[model samples]
Target: MRADGSERIVRCNEMMLSLFQCSTEKDFLELTGGCLRGMVIAEDYRQISAQLGVWQREKSADAHYLDFELCTSAAHVRRVDMYLRRIEQDGEAFWSIRLMDANMRTLMHVPGAMDGLLSRGTFYQEALRQAMKDRDMHVFGSHCPVYFNITNFKLYNASCGYAAGDRVLSHTAAVLKEMLPGAILTHLAADSFLVLAPANRLTARVEQICRRINHFIAMPGVEVKAGLRFFEAGDTSPVTSSFDEAKMACDAAKKVVKRSWAIYRKSMSDRVVLHTYILTHFTEALQKGQIKVYLQPCMRVLTEKLSHVEALMRWDDPQHGLISPAAIIPVLEESGLIHELDAFMIRSVVKLLHYQKENGLPIVPVSVNLSSLDFFEMDPFAVAEEIMERYGISHEYLRFELTETAVVRDKGTLRQALQKFHRAGYHVWLDDFGSGYSSLNVLKDYPFDLLKLDMAFLKNFNQRSRDIILSVVHMAKKLGIHTLAEGVETEEQLRFLRSSGCEQIQGYYYGKPMTPEALYAACDKGTYSVESRAESHLYYHPLRGHILRQIRKVDASQTAQMMTFSAYGRSYRVTMKRIASAQALHIYQAKFEDITEELQYDDKVRQTDDVMRNL
Candidate 1:
């Protein structure tokens, strides 16, 4: 083939004519329009031209081999392995070429002037064949094959729109090709890509590529991370193994802090195996009594008495012995099996309540935790009601506790359940009140019986945290809601909570969770104190301007009288006296306590009657 303006074929043998589907050299040239590009696919002409230009610039002494798709006269694409070199013939340079099929056995013999170039025994033929055999294995050098994929690709596609995701994929392809030229690329899966490059090349550049991908995607709630599996030179396994490892690495990368790329590790495989085993056996374990409820006591801070016990789930796997709830619950919740486990725990609590009642023991409130999944999976109110009915217990004995995050996630769905529970006379306490983003907002919107402060805050107990806790407690008090402190493990914490007016405390210092028999024994020993049984009278008067006054004695028939009282740097005054009296007792009542939202005062006073009636 001549590298000229016309790109004419200088000469061709019978075999070349046959391959081009022509009878003679002149006939083949005429059929191909006397242009070399006419016999090569138009799409590949630019790459081929670049390769030729590079070879010509180097003035290679040896023949260089290239694989190209050749278009024959019959319009059929032939895979051609060509060994060509620049030859100066008659002071006009042209390409001396030997065309062979990819197999290297059958020769599409071009009529070359040099007999050495055409000999099958030539070392160039062996070198070309060996290079072709290892073509897919090496990129620029004796490098490795790495499998990579964008993390959460489906999520990105769904959230960012498929068209945008497609653009991202296309942009990534172009960047990879441009940045790492000569790297073999393959699209193995929808989001997975394979690149054959030196291990060092991939390791040094993958992070940059992943960061660029993440930046380019730039969609909210859509992130991109790449995982890699590098193959050494000696690896003989199929390329799919690298892809599988890359997928595993991608999952592990999600847990890596601030990292966009991860290399495959064996621990990832172990975790995946354990997760799979747990998910497979969770349901059966629940039925086999392997999953049980553990009770933790919450005591009244002032009374030093048991107020309620939080029902916590624990797994006692036969093979694994005791599995921490922390270890299993998350997997169950993610798998949506927490719904059944929650139901089991609820029924178990009800049965325990029934057992306590039958045994003539004190039946304190048992607060069972309900996951956010419960509301969406089934009617949580109906579930609670059914358990109460099955055990023939009152709803008052069963208090439901939900995490702040759960309540905030689906306020409408949970609000309906909360309203139903309120109507049915069940107390709903917001668990881990200050552990989430919208604690105060949730407090303002949701009607909760109690707020359980997370113990995590008490771990430090610095001045700032103390102030925050006291302020939260004061706010809850002002709202007529009680606050309970969880994870209290020291006398300092218990005393601080008691001094801060926290209503309840639960922690390791009091006692670890006990079995049913142990709890029964502790209850009999008065493990919690009862409030003093004495009742006394105090003068009370309602003021018109959000105030109250206390007096030693006032006439029951007295009319409007203005009196002032001061507490906590706030002043209150009595505006009217509307009293009803017994023979030796005087009664003065106000619609609310000292702290009230005056704007909703009248409405709250009205609703209080209805709420009390329902209770």
Candidate 2:
């Protein structure tokens, strides 16, 4: 076979002619259309060519072997094992070919024939037979079903190539077999394995197996996770259901960092049922108005006024009472239905803004969270623009919040989306900024209008956390990116944030997420005050940095009364008092007085001098 898939019959034996039912070499060539590819069935030829292309590109191996269907002159397909070796002479490449009749049944019957494990169908069949025999001996419940998944195996294949991925899979199977000597195992699919192991010490054994696989592969960002379900005595559930439970647990394990395995529990089963209900009824829930938009007010740190409201989702499932976003969001994200939810939220927020404007109520930007799937699964920007146009809302009244994880998924698409949003005069904020390891890189590469600090920083308030949060705020300020610190529950936190020059905040410190009607009522009742656009700009003025620096330098404990500072050729008197100095950094309350006018009053200046002298 030439490199271009054309056949060159340098030598042919009589057996080859007999197999093809051809009388002479010329007849065989005519039947095959002068190419080895023509002798192969179209489907088999495509697959073989694809594999050969990969091998040729990587130059990883000299020989390739696969099972293929050869078409005879009579158009009968015969399964054969085909072997091809790359040969080069005088800078010309050729393929040395050999073929043998293959009996697939005999090949499959051999144990550990599919990458050192049983195929999916054969594994199930053998597992059933073993279950029947064990049931007869009253020992069926001694074993458990486990689902092992390679968390980022696709990345390994993409980065290291499929050949290396296959080697890892084979090594994983060998490790499983060696660790559980009497276990029944199968290669379920790409980088996934199904196993039936004895329940005794199963958790520890699975952990060892996962660790061993990781060690053997020795690749960064590649690890194994296992889910196990121990069978109870006389538990009559189908094998498929048991495996489903294991898979549910495996999914749970994948969410947590450093968690190698998880055991199936009743709670996981309940969650699975709830997930199914949510996915099935999601569309109906949206139409029936069960899925709602709730707003959490974000307060401007300098003005103590609502700068904006984050649009959060709540599912008021009648039967379930209230489905938490934590539960609902994950199910929708996994099902790729989050794009719909995001679109709904964008439309709802726009509609609410229109209502607020019509009612002569205060209108602030409503920030809606976006899932990573939105960009790939739908045109989120187009949807938002259409919704805003329909509601007669401007882009400034709505914001898009994407998490750090979402931004890291596809930088190119996200970059383009961000550019589109910015060009259209919409603000895109990086939400949960410090939740992942790639925060600095994201900030460097992407253009964001605001940074919403992850709530975890305040969840455990300490000296270290306070320092880190302040540093992030300072960095964002220097980068000309506004900052919002979430989970601000205490006045001490608010004071620290204010001193740190953080522009905005949102958390229970102001109020929890509420319905739009409730938010309107709260604003009407003076429970919350909305900041005007002019006030927002004033709070973010260039002089704010100078003021913050002065506030940070003031020793509130020692000053106690009033202090004065000069910045940008303006004299300002600021009253500094310690708010809280407990576990975290010292919180200060500063009241600035632009006393450049006071310099004209000699009597007032004399009184000020006396006060300053006493201090």
Candidate 3:
């Protein structure tokens, strides 16, 4: 249109005519009745004129913008970005106008040569920006932006080739255009699309479009699942967020065979946020002492002795208190952080051993778990040896527990690593033996000193389960491997396991997992034993009178709070005695006595000789 008030028709370029699917300028002009105003929709003509009037009145001579729907010569309507600049030519005023088809702009953003649709990356980004700007205005009536993608496009490309994939994309675009006329459509990425239309219309029509797209792309070893997320007019979130949410939905859809579509939800986003938080803070948490090592004692069922303690990792964040291993270990494993965490646990166990020796406490062998990633991080046995040696601890004081999953992940390397542990004189136990499908096979191949049975077998106590456990125990014993029943929380279960010849039992019924200090304290108390006092006079009121008589008989110059007592015809050692005065004449106070077993070998030998002589 001319800048002069006449609004005269100007020359049309051949390319512009081609965009309207016209062969020649004459044909296009005839279709529009040879008038520029006739090319625009009748409802938008007045606004276009008013905006033009404002542009002319300003006298800035700058290019003015008009975004309006154009009714083209081919009887098709498209949104257009028109740049109108005022100019003077041949001593007269005119307007140089450039028409940019919104559809073509979208197609331009696509990477390849696309016809009849916008697939250009630049166009897709611009469309998103424009959609966001329009949404911010809150004037685009009840419209929603929907994002979708072809789920199996990669498989299709891999099987059929890129040319066939391109055709599929073209066919999909054509179907979408026909189904959703006047929609603001943009091809987002390789196989994803964004469409803006009336909310009610989109919700009603998206399912049908998905069916058509799936059918169009259907082939042997090829399927198309569409995942869609709608950004409703009432939603205050920006349009850019739609892609991520929709992508998540699409991924979720891909996991289900029967489902072809999924909608984004808040819970999915929350899970993503949590996973990201754990991954981001893991290293910092380890350095800040939030990650700790705890011990759970594995006791021998036959001897009721503390065989060893298993080292388990725990996280206690200052903000989110006590994150469970079930919650944090997966993130660590997935993020490859488990390797470093496993190393840290090994070092912590070594430090615990060192601490026990320094404090004159009994040094117990501790077993630490290793991840499959630990092998990739470094030589597990070598690392363990290095830490133990650095702390001046022996390899005999440490053991390694490897899960069936970790061992099966890389059998060759892990087997080699396990062999190295054996060579280093450290016990390598296969943990969670029956948790995996390959447990029996793992047992056959790997050289494990012990088999820690998975707790699942004990969850539902039945005769069949019992038989299965008995068979496993029998097999393990035949293979010269001991079995440990984990999660043994009942007397019945403990009795059944003991009868089945399981070597160890570790669970709540025996004891729960405890800190180093608590474990040390329990071990310091040692095992309890029952004895009978043959002489009732010394045993009467044994807590006070007997202990007081023994302490009074001890000479302070000869012994330091030490005395000997006889019980069951054997002597016992009493130490750490304290005495105080009592108000009653026959009563005396005795405190802080430790009575331990002290055998009378000479008395037993003389009794044996007298019995022989009598016989």
Candidate 4:
């Protein structure tokens, strides 16, 4: 304590620090970089004699540089990042810094670090970020006393109206500011505010502040929401992409406990983090024509023909590299965005269909897969019928395939819902036939025109009996059902289906799913489509695969990285190249941290970019 009644804050200089009351003088020392400089160590006979024998190192008054490093946690690292942000907010320079971990261990000894990029601190930023997302907010990269510790980012009384909530927010912010002077404070949307402070030797000061907020919130007139996010002095990002994640936890809290305050959860995933990024890019790709429709030809193998093409959506998710239907589809489902994807495909297909009809081209039938949810919301017939009529399309030019699951789950209402199309002479094909036993009963009970065999039967071709494939073929034929044999990969399989009297074939060996131009070229000249194909070389290595497989056996992270791009459509060789890259997190980090709308306005990254700017 200073001679004055109020405690004087510790100054950066030793002269000011010495003014504080210390239990022992021995603990007081200046910090200097490296092991041999300004170190406080146990006095040993050999070291004491050696030190006494050597010249005493000069400590210049102008140096100001310390030999003693700060002790910090990963939480403290987050605090440091916040401090930089706070300083930057004040239009101050955020200097690059080398740092120390909890044990006063030198984590980084950057040469000319003040002018260099803050690389070491960046790891903590990412590490703390991941830690927060994974809900392990406790794991910090450093152990420093100077971190601004956030217990939770919760609201005080959301149950109360805006007036009461505003009062509590004001009181809470004031208390934090008073306790943590010169802290970076942000009003992170409605009742939540964040404070970033330097807490070196200020644990008592921080606890007292938390206690004050706790006391203030418990008073009952106005409740408050709060969460603690603590980290070491210097780091990257502590929370998720934004305070919204913390606020989400707060919002969830508001529903149940109606607690005045709660801690923020680090419970989101790196994938989830990346999703926030890709969503924007997908939007941009749609606008910029980067999202192109690749047509997977649903064809007849016996005739070696182009039947019709299923319009599949593909995006080079510039920020995430390439995002696939498999990776992005679940998100679309969650966001109720599957309809938008379907609409995009429908609109694109309508154009192609219009072109085909206009040119008097031999237009075969193409079908699209409808989600069960989508089918529930909008009648499949209506959507298809309207698009066809609008584009001058005939029902013969478009086939509609509903999954067996969609069929069986529909309470037999699809028959009624889709009665107009069937009556109007549009073909309805039952997709993934063998997977669902109920499909057979539905086929018998309902008015169905065609059946597409499930790829599962073909996946087990070397093992399954020919009788199994033939039974399906013969039954459909006897029932006046036209059959499309899917997953026909090999020439042998194609010939076998032909001899067995299958009506159509669609699979990689016939020629992979292609665009309209690609469909024309590959179908007309049939070796393979190289330009837009995922051959084994894109991801798989023959000799390299063997080596990588061995390397992957020992490395879990590398093996996990390998699973992202899997070939799904290949019957024999569905060349699995991921529309998105294997390194999703890395891609997100690169795309986000440095994003500017003026530079690369990736649709997925804009919001994240905005939030990161605030962070």
Question: Highest TM-score among the candidates is held by which one?
Answer: 2
Best by lDDT: 2
Error of 4 at 243 (Å): 18
The digit string of per-residue lDDT tens for model 3 on 541-583 reads: 3443545455565434333365556555455455533332223
Residue 572 alpha-carbon offset, candidate 4, angstroms? 37
lDDT (10s digit) by residue, model 2, range 22-59: 79988776556555544564334545666776766665
Worst 10 residues of 1 by lDDT: 532-541
lDDT of 1 at 127: 29
Candidate 2 shows a clash count of: 0
Which clashing pairs does model 2 show? none
**lDDT of the candidates, in the order given:** 0.66, 0.77, 0.68, 0.49
> What lDDT, from 0 to 1, does candidate 1 have?
0.66
Q: Model 4 lDDT vs. the true structure?
A: 0.49
Clashing pairs in 3: 106-118, 107-118, 107-119, 108-120, 109-120, 109-121, 109-123, 110-119, 110-120, 110-121
Cα miss at 524, model 4 (Å)? 5.5
Model 4 regions lying over 4 Å from their true place: 1-270, 277-284, 359-361, 523-615
Residue-level error in angstroms, candidate 2, position 181: 2.9
If the candidates were sorted by their lDDT against the true structure, best first, what order would they fall in? 2, 3, 1, 4
Residues 171-235 of candidate 1: C-alpha lDDT, one tens digit per residue = 67666666566666544344655565546667668777777777887765455566676555555
Instruction: Give the Cα-based TM-score of candidate 4 against the true structure.
Output: 0.43
